[model samples]
Target chain A: MLSVAEIINLLNSIPVGYKSPEDNCFNAANQMYIPEYKKLGVITVANELQDNLPEADENDLFCDVPGCQIAFENSASYQAHFYNVHRYLCSVCRRCLPTAHLLCLHILECHDSYFIIRAKRGDAMYSCFLGECKVKLPTPKQRREHCINKHKFPANYRFEQLCGKPYKRHTKKPSKSVEANEIVDDMDVVADIPNMK
Target chain B: MEVDPDEPKTSPSTSRSPTQHIRDRNRQVAQQHREEQRAKTIDTVRFGLGEVQEEVEELDELSEQDINGLITRITRRKHASAEEMHKLSEAFLQSMDNIKLFFEAPGALQVIVKEIIGLDSGCQVGALECLCNLSLGEAPVCEKIIHQGGRNLVQCLDSPDERLKRTSLWIIANTISTSPKAAQTVVQMNIVPKLFYIYLDDSGEKNIANEFREDAAVCLQILVMGKNRAARQEDITFIKDNMIKKCRNSVAAEYHLKIIFHADIVNPRNEFNIEQTHHLMDFILGNLYTTPDFGSIANRLRIVYAIRVLSNMVQCVPTTTIDAMRQQLRGVWETHLEVLLNKVFDFGEDLLSLEVVYLIRNLIHDKSPQPLPCQLDRLEVPNIDYEKLLPQEWK
Candidate 1:
C-alpha cells in the first residue's frame, strides 16, 4: 500500500546507501537487526511489510454487507456476493435491488419518509427527513416522489445532510443533474441560515 | 379445548382394572402438574433480596436546593473540602429535579468537569460521583455529558485511583442506560470493547496494580447495569406531565409516532443511526451474559439493565436486521440457553425475575419467535395455565 514517495522515504531511513546513521535516530537506537541495524532493520521491515500484506488478488476483497463475512478472490467475486447471497432489500421500501451498488443508490434516492405516521401499519416507521414531513410514506421511492411532486420540492432539494454529506450513504453519482431551485451560496450551516428571496 | 365426559367414558381407562390403573393415572397427573409449575415459574425466578443482597454503594443524602447550593459553592470557592464534595456528589443521584437545575445553570457542568481533573482526591471523587449520579434516570443530563466528548470521562477509567475509575465507568454506564443515543455515543468513543478487555484482564501482577482492592472485572460489570429509570414509562410520563412544556421526544411524540424517539428537535444529530443500532445488537450479543456465575444477586441485577436496554433497542429494529442476525443468533441463543440453564432457576430477586419475563415476551412476536439471539425449547409445549395469571382478554 506504500506509495513511491513513502517507499523512498523509508529507504532513506537506511544509512548504508547515504551516510553514517544519526546518533539519536529511532532506526539507529532500535531495530530488528543488530548487524548494521539502521540499514538492515529498515530494509528488513519494509520487505516484511510488503511480503505480509495480502495482494489485491485472492483475499484482498470482502463482502461489505453488514453480516456477510466471506472474502472474495477478486472484484468479480466480490460483486457476485450481492447476487449470490445478499437479497439487497431495503427495510422500508421492500423492493429488491439488483446489485449492492444499486441498493446503496436506491436507499439514497428513495427512502425518505422518516416518521411512523398512524396506526395503519406497525407501531414505528422509518423516515429520511424525520420530523419535517406531515404524513409518512412506507417506501423510499414513494417518499422521494412525495417530496418532489406533492410538496413541490426542487429536484436537488436535499432532506438533510449528516456530517456535511447527504443523509444516506453515497453510492454512485446521480445520472442526471439534481437542479436546485436556487444556489446555496457560501453559507455552510443551512439550518440556522434563512432562505434568500 | 372443551373436554367431555363422553370422551373419558369411551377411553380404555374405563375398561381397565381399578387399583394399578388408578395409581398410574395419579402418578401421571402429579408429574404433569409439577412439570407445568416448573415451566411457568422458570423465567420468573425471584431470589430473596436479603439472601443474595450485595452492598449498594452509599451516598450521603442532600436536599434538592442543597444540590444547586453545593455546585454554586464549588464554583465560587477557590478550594473545597473532600468531605463536602463527596456529600454533594452522593447527593446528585438523590433527585432528578436538582440535576436538571444544575445542568440548566450556565458553566456549572464545565466547572464540575474541571474539578474532576483537579489534584484534590476529594474534589475528583466528589466530581466523579456527581457526574455518575447525574447520569442516573436523567436522559437530558446524560446527553449533555455524552455530547461534551463524554467529558473526557472515559479517560478517567485509566486513573490509578480505584474510586475514580469505578465512578467514571459507572457514570459512563449510567449515561448509556439513559437512552440509545447515549449508549451509541459511548460505544462510538470505542470504550465498549475496552470494557470487555478490562473484564478479560483478571490475571497476573496487573491484578495487584488495581487500586480498589476490588476485582478487575467489577468496572465492566457495573458499566452494563442497564437502562436508567427514564426509559420506564412511568418515569417518562411523570417527567412529561409535570413539565410545563413537552420535549420533542416526550410522551407526545410517542402518541404522534415520531421517528427520532430519543432525539431533541433542537439537536437532532444525537439520535442513533442504523450502524449504532447494529453496534448495540453486537454489544448485547457479546456481553449480555458477561456477569459472574449465575445465582449471584449482584449478577442478576446487572443483567436486568443489560436485557432492558436490549429490549428498548430491538423496539426500533426493522425486519431486515432480524433477517441478517438470524444466522449469527445461533451462538448467542446457545449462550442464552446456557445462562438460563445455570443461573435463572434460583434467581430470587423480584425485579430480576420479572425483567426476564419482560425480556422473553419482548423477543416473541405474533406466533413465531424471531431470531432473538437465543433459543428456548424448554417451554415450546404450552402446558401452563395462562388464564390463571393473565387477564380475561389476554387469555
Candidate 2:
C-alpha cells in the first residue's frame, strides 16, 4: 500500500495545481486507502512481519475450493473460479461475479435485494445484517438496503459496497465457522421438515 | 467558320478538260517508271529498311521527351500577346494531332509526360485533358500518373471559388474513374474532408439552383463513397454532423441525400473505428424507412447502396465484435428491421440491396438468449423491449 506521503509525492508530480493543499492531501489519502491494498498487500505484510507469523508460508497461495490442492494463479483467477464454478456468470458482462465492479453497480442501481444477495455471496455464511430479515440476499446492495430500511439504523449502517460489508455497528458479528455450523443445522431442520411434510 | 478555297475542288476527272487528263496520265506513267526503277534497285536503296524501321520503332518507343519539348515551347511563349496566343492556340491544336500520333507509337514521350503535363497551370488543363483521354483509352498513362506524383493533382482542390472546385473534382473524378489506384490515392490524400468542407460552406450561400448544389454534392458523394480511412477522424466527425445532417434536412435538393448516404457509408460517425462504417450503414437502414418522407429516387437508391456495401463489409468483420454490437443494438435492429425490409429490395442487382437482405435475414435469424449475434445457433426470435433490456440481476 502506498503511504500518505508517497501518495502526496505522486499528486505533487502532476502539473496542475489543486484548490488547496488540504484538499489535495485528503484526495491523495483517499486514493491510497483502497481495500485491495489493505487486504491483499499491506495487512498480510504487517501480520507476517509482526511475529514472524506461523501462517506466513501459506499466505502466498489460495486454492479455488477449500481442501482442493490446485493453486490459483492470481486474484483474478481465483475470482474467475468463483464465478465459473459457483455462480456460472459471464466475466465481461458481470453476470454473477460478486467482485465484478460493473455487476455490483448494476445490482446497487437496479435491484431491490442488494444486501441479502451480498452477504450470501461472501466467503462465509452469516446472519442477516437486518434485524428482521433472515433471507440471504445475493449482493451488497440488498444487504445495505435491508439494514437501512428494515433495521432503521441510519447512523450505524456503513454501506461501502466496494470493500466494506454492511455491518451493524453495535453487534458482535459471529465468525464464519460458527455461522457455518448454524447454517448446517438450519439446513438440516429445513430438510427434515420437508421429509415430515 | 471560314472555309479555305485554295484546295482542289471535288469532282470527277472526266469533267475536267481532256488536256488536263492527258497531263495527269503522263505524270502517272512517269511516276510508275520511276517506281519500277526504284523497286528494281532494292539492294542499293533499300539496304537499311528493316534496321531503319527498327530504329524508328525504338525512337517511337521513347517519344515522351519529344512531346514534352513541344509542350515546353508553348509554355515558354506565355501567349501574352494576341498573336502569340493565336500561334500558341494553333500549336495546341497541332499538339492534339501530335498526341494522337505519339500515343499510337508505344513509348513515345512516355517518360516526362507527367512532368510536362504538370508544368504550368495553363498546361495542367491540357495535361489533365490528355490524362482524361489516356484514361479513356487503355494507355499505360494511368499507371504513370499514379506513380508520378499523381496525388499532387489534388492541390487544385483548394480553390475558394465554387466553379473551380467543381471543375477540379470533375477532373479528379474522371481521372480516378479508370484508375482504382488513383481513386485509392485520392482517398489517401483525404479528398473527402476537403470536398465535404466545400459542400457545406458553398451549398446554400449563393442560392444556387439545386441543380448546381446537386452537382457539387455529387463530387462529395463520390469522394465519400470512396471510403477513405486515411481521412482524419475530425473531418469524419464534421462531415457526420454538418454535411450529413444538412443533406438529410435540406429542402433544396434530393441529391444531397446521396451525400448523406455516401458519408454514412464511409465514416458513419465523426469518430473513427472499423465499426463506424457498419454503424452508419445500420443507421441508414434504420432511418430509410423510419423517416416520415424517404426523399427522392436517387437518394433512396444511394441509401440502398450504402446498406449493401455495409452488409458486405460486415461479413468480413469478426463475429465476436458483431455479436457484442448486436446485443448492444437489439432495439435498433428490432424497430428498424421492418422499415429497412420495405425499402431494402429497391436496389436491384446492386450489392447494397443484397446487403440489406443479409442484415435483415441475420437479424430475424439470430436467436441468441443474449441480445447479440454470435457464432452460436441463430435466433429465430429476438426479445427486445427497451425497458427489460437493462441489467435486471446482480450478484
Candidate 3:
C-alpha cells in the first residue's frame, strides 16, 4: 500500500551510474575486456567441440547419472527410482553398492579420514551412513561402538586411516597438449594423517 | 396415547416401528418430487424455453439485432436471471460480432457493471464474464469500460466467489492489455496490491486454486509489462516493497520475478533502469543459495526461475551497462558463477542442470562487444574434462 509519491521517490532513489569499484580485477591499461583466446600473449588452438547429448524432453524426467538413461513419467516415479537403484551410489567415491548396509560399511572403511576431518571441523558427521537409520552420536568413539554393534563393522578394523583410494572411472582426452601441473595424482592418505590418537 | 392390541406396540425410547417408517419415507419421496417439479418450472420460466439445451443453441444463432435485443433486455430488466446472463455471456465469448454489438449498444457497459454490483454472486459471475468478453473489443470499448465500470471491476476482485474473482481479474487483464491508457486508468484505481494479495495471500478457509493465482499473475504481468510507464512503475514499486524487501514467500517472489522476466522478454528495450536491474539481480542471486531447505522440489524450481530471470536480464541490457555492473558487483557475480558451475554437475536433477547450462551459455556467449575477462577465466574450457563432466552414455 505505497503512495504514488513514495513509489516515485523510491524509483528516483535508485542510482543511475554504477559506483566506482573498491578493487578492480581488470588492468587499467586495457580498456576492453578481451577474451583469453584473443589475447596477444596467449597461444590459440582450433578445437572443434561437439554437442553429442540429445535434447531434453520437457514431459519426461531423465536420470542424471552418467551411464543411466532411464526416463520416468513423473518426479514421484523418478524419486522412487533414485531411492531404489541409486541411493547407495556414494557421493565421495561414486561406487554403487548392493545394499544400504554395505554402502554404510564402504563409507566407514574407505572414507574414515574424510569423516575424521569433518568431525574435527565440528560438522554433524556421526550420523549413520545408512539412509534409513537416524542414529546420531556426538563423539567418534561412540559412533565407532554403535557401528560395530548395530551395523556389524569389523571389531578391530582401523578407523583412523583412509583404507581405500578413489580411482578415475572415466578420463577425457585433453583438447590441448597436457601440462605437467594438470596431471592429478592419487590421494596420499599417509601424508595427510599425523599421529593417530 | 393408548396403543391398540392389533397395532404393533413400540417403546417410548426405542426406534420407530416399520409402519411409521414407511409412512415417513413416503412423505420424504413426495417432498423431493415437489422440489424437483418446482425447479423444472423455475428453469422453464428463467429461459422462457422448454429446455436449456435448446436455449443455448438459439443463443449461438443470435444475429446482430438479436444481440442488441439481449442488451436492451438487460438494460430494461436489471434483475435478469443468472441463466439468461450466462447464456448471453457465452454468446458474446463465441462471436466477435456479439462483442461489437455489446459496445455499440448505448449504456451496455453501465448496465452490465450495475448487474455485477447489484446481483447475487451467481448473477455477478455471469455479468462479470460478459463484461470480460466485452472488454476484449476494440480499444474504445476497453476505454469506455475503464472509465465507466472500473471501480466495479476492482470491487469484484474482493468478491467471495472464486469464479467471480477470477473473471474480474481476467476482465482487468483484458482491459489493460488493450491499450496503455486503459492500463494506466486501471492502475489509478490501485488494484495492483489487491491482485498481489490474491496471489500471495495464504491464509484462507480453503486453498485458492492455482488457476485463480495464475490469472492474477497474468494481470500483474500485463500491467507491469504494458507500455504504460506509470503502471509499470507502480507495480514494480509494489513488488519491491512487498515481495522483495520483506521476502515473505519464495513462491510469490518467483512469480514476481517471472513477471519481470516476461516484461524483459516482451519489451526487450530494457524496461528496467540500472538501479532496478541491480536490485533484481542481487535479490535473485541472494535467493539462489539461501533456500531454506536447499534440495526440495520447490526450492529447485525457484532456482530455475532465478537462473532464467538472470539470463534474460543479462541479455536485455547493453554491453557497457553489463560491464559497469560487472565491475560494481564482482563478488556477487563470482559467487553466483561458482554456484551455477556446481549446479551444472549436480547429478540429482536434470532440469536444474539444463537451466544452469543455459545461464552459463548466456554468460559466455553474451552479445557484448568484447568478451568479459571474468567470463573467459571462469569457463576455463581447456581444463574441463568432457568425458567426466557429461553423461557417458550420450558419448
* Two-way lDDT contest, 2 vs 3, winner: 3
Candidate 3 residue-wise lDDT at B288: 67
lDDT of 1 by residue, A1-197 (tens): 23344333432332221111121222311231122101000000111222233344332456776655666533333433444234555565344443344345445444433321321244322233312234555544455566555433345544333112233346455343421211121112222211110
| Candidate number achieving the greatest TM-score relative to the actual structure | 3
**Alpha-carbon interface RMSD of model 1?**
36.8
Which residues of candidate 1, in runs, are more than 4 Å off? Answer: A1-197, B1-69, B77-81, B149-151, B204-395
Q: Residue-wise lDDT of candidate 3 within B1-395, one digit each (tens)? A: 97686554545324877777666545544654454334223321112112333534543455677777777887787555555565566556556677777777777666777667542344455567667666656688888887777766775565554556666777787777776777777776566777777777564333333256656766786666423343555565566555533242533454556565534331254355555655666666655655543355346435655666665555556453465456535665555355444543443343344344444445544244465523423432222222333323333
Global CA lDDT of candidate 2, please? 0.37
Chain A TM-score, each candidate: 0.21, 0.18, 0.25
lDDT of 2 by residue, A75-185 (tens): 333433443233423333223322233233434333424433443456322334421234445444455565445433243323432121222346456687866443222
Higher-TM-score candidate of 2 and 3: 3
When just chain B is superposed on the true chain B, each candidate scores a TM-score of 0.42, 0.43, 0.59
Q: Which stretches of model 2 miss by more than 4 angstroms?
A: A1-197, B1-139, B143-152, B180-192, B199-202, B205-247, B250-287, B290-297, B309-340, B343-356, B367-395
- Best model per lDDT: 3
Q: What's the best-to-worst order under lDDT?
A: 3, 1, 2
TM match of model 3 to true structure: 0.43
Better of 1 and 3 by lDDT: 3
